[model samples]
Target: MELRDISRRVGIAAGVVTVLALAAPYAVLSGGSYASQLADYYASGVVGGAGIALFALLSVVVVASVERGNLDPGTLAGAAVVLGVATTLSAAAWATAIEPSPMFRDNLWLVWHARVVVALSVLIPVAAAAYARELLA
Candidate 1:
């Protein structure tokens, strides 16, 4: 396959990985009920993990449908960069803006959640950079 094709595939792969990180076991709040977990998550002032995941998922679809279909390398790279930066900011906000209530802070799960988001945030940029470098070359 061409280098452009490889870059496109890699960008999609990175985006999928980011979505998974956003959705995976952010926290298992007390009572072990899904509702309770959701409630606890939303109680935080910031957007929850699910929201971040959904946004990232939509971004991936846009990349696949719009950029990939047209084989527009420059547009694809630009989209990747914009999406990556937005995801990074949103993830960072979600991780940091979470209320420091006992419920949130007391759980080790919250720390893990932050770590996952932070990691994904980093991955987005790297993926974007890779795509941009290939397109620009």
Candidate 2:
């Protein structure tokens, strides 16, 4: 079709590829070694898994925006629902970090925090998946 369209697609693809490539290792490392992973994330030693996950998410959203940019407000509203989940996760992570309760110190709350963060994070990925399906359709 058009050169501009081709170039834009190529650029977006390149960006997605670069992000995944750079971030995948960190995610793997994080999964294998939690302390090292958290240190890396905290010290900015590498891109955090959360950041990469968000990038993957936004990538799919961009795809949807490019393809079915005219989706009804209903779908947009569905997407917005994830924002609350994200906020909750962010808040939990922050609160626990700032003032660790005895519960948090006991590893029980830590597990809960991790579970909530992960579960909350899935909301975006799932939405992004739906967006990708609609876009690719």
Candidate 3:
């Protein structure tokens, strides 16, 4: 396959993974009742949950823009990168803000979940940018 095609596939895969990560707790929560609760807690808020959804949506937009071969792929990718960075910063801030709370401090699982979400936020834009580079190349 061409490098651009491969990059596109990888970008799509990354988007899928991000969506799954946002949906299921098995990846971060290790599967249990508490897993759902922690997942809900992190994903329920506007800054936390809405940010994740926006990130995932941007990831898909990057891939779709490339596939459509109409809009400027680089611009879309660049936007994703900017948004991803913003999301990461917000998530980190959110985590720090909540970390001192009794619920966050008491639950190690919540800490792990926050870290995973932040990591995924970092990855989504990276994958998008990589695909854009390959497309431009």
lDDT of 2 by residue, 12-127 (tens): 45335534543433454455435553454333313344543454455445543544558763454345335424433553453344333343343443434433444444444344
lDDT of 1 by residue, 1-137 (tens): 87656655665676788776665553334355455554656444356666666656655665565454576667766777787777777777777766544555456675667667667666665666666776688
Q: How do these models rank on lDDT, best leading?
A: 1, 3, 2
The better-scoring model by lDDT among 1 and 3 is 1
lDDT of 3 by residue, 27-135 (tens): 5445555565555565544476657666666766666676675877677767766755665676566555442334455555555765676676666567666766776
Off by over 4 Å in 1: 1-7, 26-37, 42-47, 65-71, 100-107
Per-candidate TM equals: 0.70, 0.34, 0.65
lDDT of each: 0.64, 0.43, 0.62
Rank candidates, TM-score, best first: 1, 3, 2
Which pairs clash inside model 3?
none
Stretches of candidate 2 off by over 4 Å are 27-39, 42-49, 69-137
Candidate 3, poorest ten consecutive residues by summed lDDT: 94-103
Best by TM-score: 1
